[model samples]
Target: MPHDQLPTQAHAFLRQRHNELGIPGLARRWREVRAQIRANGTWRPTYDELAYAARVAWRNSGRCIGRLRWPSLIVRDRRHITTLHDVGRELAAHLDEATNGGRIRSVITVLAPATNAGPPPVRIISPQLARYAAWPSREGVLGDPANLALTRLATDLGWSGPTRRGPFDLLPWIAATADGVLHLLPTDPMHILEVPIQHPNHPWITDLGLRWPAVPVISNMTLTFGGLWFPAPFSGTFMASEIATRNLADEHRYHQLPAIITGLRLDDRDRLRTDKALLTLHEAVLYSFEAAGVSITDHHRESRAFARFAQHEEAADRVVVGDWSWLNSYPMTPQDPSWSRYYHPGQPTPALLRDPYCLALTAGHPKPGHEPSPRQRADVPPGRCRHTQPRKGGHVSTRTPVKAHRRLTRLAAAAVTLAAVTAGLVGVSGGPAQAAGCRAAPYSAKFGAADYFMQYDGVEVISYPKYPSYYRTTSQCRDIQVRNTGDGVDFGPFYACVNFYGRSGCNYWTYVPVGQWRNLATNVKDGTKFYVWVRIDMGKYYGFRAVGDW
Candidate 1:
């Protein structure tokens, strides 16, 4: 288990890939890899094979409707990067070349793989080169909801803002080493090219402050092929929906429609405002990119191109599989030919795989608080606070100021206190902390429950200036396998989210409550010390330790 000794099948797999790609020197490469496997229990692909694999991954990506142009991907061989400085330099170059001065070329830069056999390779953590800050506010998310945690992590690393975070702010690059140590990569401001959005038909649309980076460079995905993996950063020109429908129009994102509707003097009170604003926003994205001389493909045009590409693949005897939900998520779906069809999730010769969350935890996020969710009890009215009572059926309703009652009273005495306190309860409320000596200790009920198992211990809250976001684990713990059964949540095993602003700070915490959790001990034969954490939904991420039968 020291190194995944490349088997005979690996050599064949590489050879088939090379031959199918029409690359010369397939036999020589196979022999080279085979000898490396026999001698060192590893295989390092040649540059040609690496480039071919990168393109094949693009072709195999089922969710990307723009894969029709996979052959156009320009691969940069940077697999020799040793230090974080080199990564930043190479990534800047990738952005410059992919930006194409504004036209936006599709390109990918492949980097060094994980040297060790057990964990994933080092990867860039940002979803894109440019992202907004999701600061904690009484108002809704100021920037992209999807990038809230990353924004907080960037701020934690001493990256300050131009000022308070706005709807558009370029985030610095963050990458991890093979060991999972995170490093911040500073990008030269000039290298990031952003285009302001304007609508050709609606002249007033320019008043709305909306913009996006020219290139969508994804850095977190692992490129796996023939028993080898590379932390690859890939870039592509924007498809209109990526900018219009999702980035600009999605409620969690920019939520530009309300402003646009106001600017256009359209009636926003009507339910149809969202639908009308969506089309208008979609048109604005298409118009702005073109006017700015940026490269973009409208969904209708891209869908038509995809149909042709599918036919071309079929003629070559290749089954073109795709994810329908992603393909259909475009605007004016019925108008596009792609909306009419279903696709199989095709297997690629080389796949762009997502790195496991356990590997991601090596970046050193804080651990989670061992707090139980404040479940509303039947005795308490709908809006009243439900504090854990020591007795089975009885409850302690504190009408006293929450901060004052640090200790618990006897159930019979507490009932009398509750009667006196209910009048004052309208103004006073208990904070997160309560007396530990109470019949039921704070969060103890959650741990002692028969069905609830402790995943970690000694979790401490790490403070961020805006909101205390991360938790660090003091105790050692194993990774827990997680299955995201929710349709919207995209997380791996051992994911948790801590929202400081949850219900305006009452009933604020929840862990991996919905997943199918299991112990990874049997699988981790070497006892890999996995530092795991919970990335709560659109909130701060908390680290966790295993609570061993506590």
Candidate 2:
């Protein structure tokens, strides 16, 4: 029971337990852990300690926006169950408890932990407990593109999909147990509760035959608590945007925007048609889940709840670490309280760690090698986050270069009349010679959707970086022109700000309309340097260019 014999992580976890929960008998527990570690090289956590650690892991999960309900997580200890058949049985029970007859309770089932003297712990190889199978064909990928690797792995493991493979086919679970055997177990259809998507106003939208599972159970991540790693699968109800904007509407996924727009018989030529369609799809998901009496949350509500959670954490003297890009909702709006703020950054321990071997196994690659230790696996980087830093002037194109060129040509043609007017205004001033034709390169911008949410694509022009302030006269001012080159959509109510510093100094919100050139004049001293920034306010893809003379 010597202090030097116990690992630092175990001591740290015990100290955290005492500090956070005021758990009694800290000295006795510390002695017991030390003795256990001295005897067996690891110490087992009591059920209460294990449950608290799991809840803390959820509370510390930076990527989850619905962490406000972390305390409500139901932790089911299945450490005694090590065989594949038992693991599958427990997983089914977990699904049933999580599904909760459409109420969708947050639940986690913790299986056997890796030990020094025993066989390897039970591991679930699927990323999620209920993911659709993907099949490649001559036509194209028939199901979720994200699951292609998983489907291939399942097929290789002697798991056959439906007789007639189609979209929305449920995938079987792959589990590797302590018996050194890999097992492919099919998910019971009754355990999967799904709500059919349909719009209240648009009856024809039901023809799309889209449905989503009531609960999303993440199965691949390893839960690390009290210096022990457990294969813990957890679940929660879906955020509507996750299904509507990401899973079903992402270009790499179902890409249902075009189909929904076509179904609505909306003009594709209209710039705002895509925005309307996205809104409709989101609305449909909400309506369908609510009508079915299933639990689901929208981005707006989730954002506000996260803000409250942050407040509570701060009040309890805890730093709320988060990835801003993941916290922000897809199809981001200015109105969300969480959008304009930043959080403390760092991945805290007593958290879920992504094991590379487990990731590979889930992705259909089962290579033979020694599995990396938890310390090695914990170094995995966080996912992509939103970019807010200022970018240099260049032609940023989300589309092909040829399409960008065509848009640039059209932009030039449309700006001809405005250029002529500006030329006349410069000539009429006639005070001193000035650099009146300084133009920044055109840039493209788009709203948050799918993987594009992490990008900062906007029209930005900085004067000090390219053109010095000496190019202008004392009597003359600069007029910044922002032109939208996108397909006929009106973009803003967005801000066009002139800043002496960078984006941080941009305080003014000057609204600019898209599909045309609009001039915003900055009246400043001759030797002053400034920059103009413009970003879209609405949820639609847009292309814009900012040009100004110093």
Candidate 3:
């Protein structure tokens, strides 16, 4: 659409520029833009206009929680670059400048914008300039499950990864030009600043060998302003939670929590073990980045900063719009100031918008008819990539030999099992009385079995201790009843016991059917603690609740 025909957006942006920056002669500039649009059906944004618009786009981004530094964003206007080679070179330069040797700086490189003549001159196909490759096999996904499609697409484009693939393998950059050509460019390892994840308190965490990029450069979103779309790639130092809580801890992503919990050897007897593990992971991510001199922020600090940003916006008579879900951190606590407040909840231009073609390309599925031909495959030679090279300072290379990688995998698996067994004890709550005068608390267990139908060969145990002040005893209670709360097949013939430390005196095993309660006889004692042991025949998950008269 011509800017002269629908001049509302163009006029709004220009007026904002005038109001905020006090740029004189706004009416004269608008007339010039109108004349350009009348003659050529589109108007070009001057470098000054483009830079300010990019900064304003960050300010208007509803999903961003770090908009406090909007005015400090460094914008690179590369509107003249039209070739894929130049795009690759500029991207490498962007990484070097933004990374800044671990003291990351926020930067955005704005390429050619979409015009009436054609689409953007160059478009980045990767979701982030720095992302790991995901190679799927019969065993499991070797890298990130989230990037499997993209990994497969890269391989199909003749970009074979290292001779021995391991997790945390950096993917090659993919770019497409207006002439329908695809280019696969290798990322220079020196430019990719990586921080090895290690916990300050837990030294064993380093053994797992996890690392993350210092700066996250988002490449797939378009910077929309004044009725034009620019394929802009932007970067900011990571927020610790984005790496620890989401990227590494999410089940569909790296899923490192279970391993971390196992390494911590936290007793499952504590009801908050999972939460503790998550916090520990967050601390490790923060510590690792800080130790490496990489710029990072914790959730609490970022939330407080955002609160201040909102205050400043309100002071300026600007309505703060934000997506509440995105603004708050995962594993969020009420202590954060952002937890209690609300904001105007809609997206407003100028904004960074996700284009469908970019999304598809990032997902490893290009536009159906635009698939690259045989000649378009750009594969790098094996030894030429620096990721496969040995580190200079006696540091271990990320690319482990295939045999060593398998051995490490086996050790990790063993550690997980041992951790589960060592911390097998569960906690149950004593709450309000249910029917038959029994106080119940809900409990659930995650089976370690990989197959859904296969039975977890290990025993699932729960204990109510006597020494802990918070623990409830069966002294006042007579009989204990257990109800199967799971949706899967029935479980148990539970063994109820009264124990002193490791020794136990128990009764005969009593069976409990699905959704039904079974009263099991227990020998109540003053000093001994109560315990329940059950085994499920099928399913990867089990849920139950125990009720006793207290």
| Reference-based TM-score, model 1 | 0.68
Which residue runs does candidate 1 get wrong by more than 4 Å? 1-5, 22-28, 117-122, 268-271, 358-548
Q: Model 3: what TM-score?
A: 0.66
Report how far residue 333 has shifted in candidate 1, in Å: 2.1
By TM-score, the best candidate is: 1
lDDT string, candidate 1, 364-432, tens digits: 222122121111111222221111001122211222223212111111111110100111111111121
lDDT digits (tens) for residues 1-550 of candidate 2 = 1335336778788889888986688888899988888888888899988998999999988768899999999999998986666787888899899988888899999888877564356788677888888889898889886676666555544456777877898887876555433446646778888888999899988988898888899887678866678888988879998898778887667879999989889986889897888899999999999999999999899889998999999999999877665677466455787776666546676887543334533432111231111222222235433220001221122122354333322221111110001011111111123433433332211121111232222222221121112122233335444454344442233445554421112335466554455555545566543444443422233233323333
* Poorly placed runs, candidate 3 (over 4 Å): 1-6, 364-550
Against the reference, the lDDT scores of all candidates come to 0.54, 0.62, 0.63
Q: Which run of 10 residues does model 1 get worst, by summed lDDT?
A: 417-426
Superposed model 2: Cα runs more than 4 Å off: 1-6, 117-119, 178-181, 364-550
In model 3, state the lDDT of residue 298.
81
